[model samples]
Target: MGRHETISRRQLVQVQDRFIAAWGQMGAAWGVSRTMAEVYALLYITAQPLNTDDVMDRLRISRGNASMSLRALAEWGLVSRAHKRGDRKEYFIAEQDVWALSRKVMRERLRREVLPLLATLHELRDATDNRTEQPAGAPLRLASDDEPAPADARKPVTAAEVRQLNDRIDSLLELVQTVDRLGERFVGSDGKGLRLAANMLSKII
Candidate 1:
């Protein structure tokens, strides 16, 4: 067992304040609300689970705002609920391990954002392919074997444009799929692969 050093009240407050502010900024970049990120940051640094009133008071947020933020964090699996032995009020705690928290966030983002966008891209590609498969207007075969065809052949021109558009869409779809696979690998293997990569990079630098 290791001995624990006592942290002064002022030092603890300062640390918590810094974490909350920095996390609020990071939260926006991560596509989550600043308040939600602050709440998680506060919970993460606290040694004990915090009740709703405690969170609202410390964060200087309205009860509704704290409640909603906590709920969202819980939904994302970044925060969890706790119950004190004799207390009827609910308490919440944040997941403290940075790597695990990040993995959860990435997993949720892949499910909510990346996967849906990929599906939409697939639909667009399918629609474009269907349009390209059919003749643009009608067959443009010459009536006479020796007759010179019209300079403006609408059929070929339109078909070529449609095929070109479909090809572009196919390329975009492939890029998105590749990104999706990379995300899966990053957060997969229970985050072991990610940790290993981070360790290797640290040594290389």
Candidate 2:
């Protein structure tokens, strides 16, 4: 092998293992399977496309596991299926466009986490609106004039305090809405808006 044929030597195994494990952990935190993330990391770092057998061999995963991971990655738009002219076996490659990859990930995360969070916040804000009605979507009201707390059991909340709490919740809702809109622009703009915003923010900062 030439001096620059590949990475350094046997010692590099440690680095590769560490990177794969770290990537898997990160993916797990983001609601992805650990092995699937490790597989994607491997395909990302590898310049050439690899087949199921190759992935299984490299990752020490079973064939079923490798196929399932690859299929999931393709579904997520993070990996692409490939083919060779003379070979019949299916191969896979990772999406090299990091910006697109990041956008997809953020889009999914926002749908999974942020959207639900906003719903919950909206419900909370409505609850703070002093509406004591017990609807299906609305949160349960704590105290109301009709059903006041027992004397000396708990300190009665003042109207001023309620207004202050509503204001605070409103502030939070506004901030979250702003973030949701920005995220929509970033993910929906196909990288143009993201780059523009990042460049402008960098210059301003």
TM-score attained by model 2: 0.71
Candidate 1's C-alpha runs over 4 A off are: 1-8, 131-157, 199-205
lDDT of each: 0.86, 0.85
What value does the lDDT take at residue 131 in candidate 1?
Answer: 48
Listed in order, each prediction's TM-score against the native is 0.78, 0.71
**Winning candidate number (lDDT):** 1
lDDT of 2 at 11: 54
Give candidate 1's whole-model lDDT: 0.86
Residue-by-residue lDDT tens digits, candidate 1, 10-126:
998998899889989999887999999999989988857999999999999999999999999999999899999989999998898888888888889999999999988777666
Cα displacement (angstroms), candidate 1, residue 157, comes to 5.6
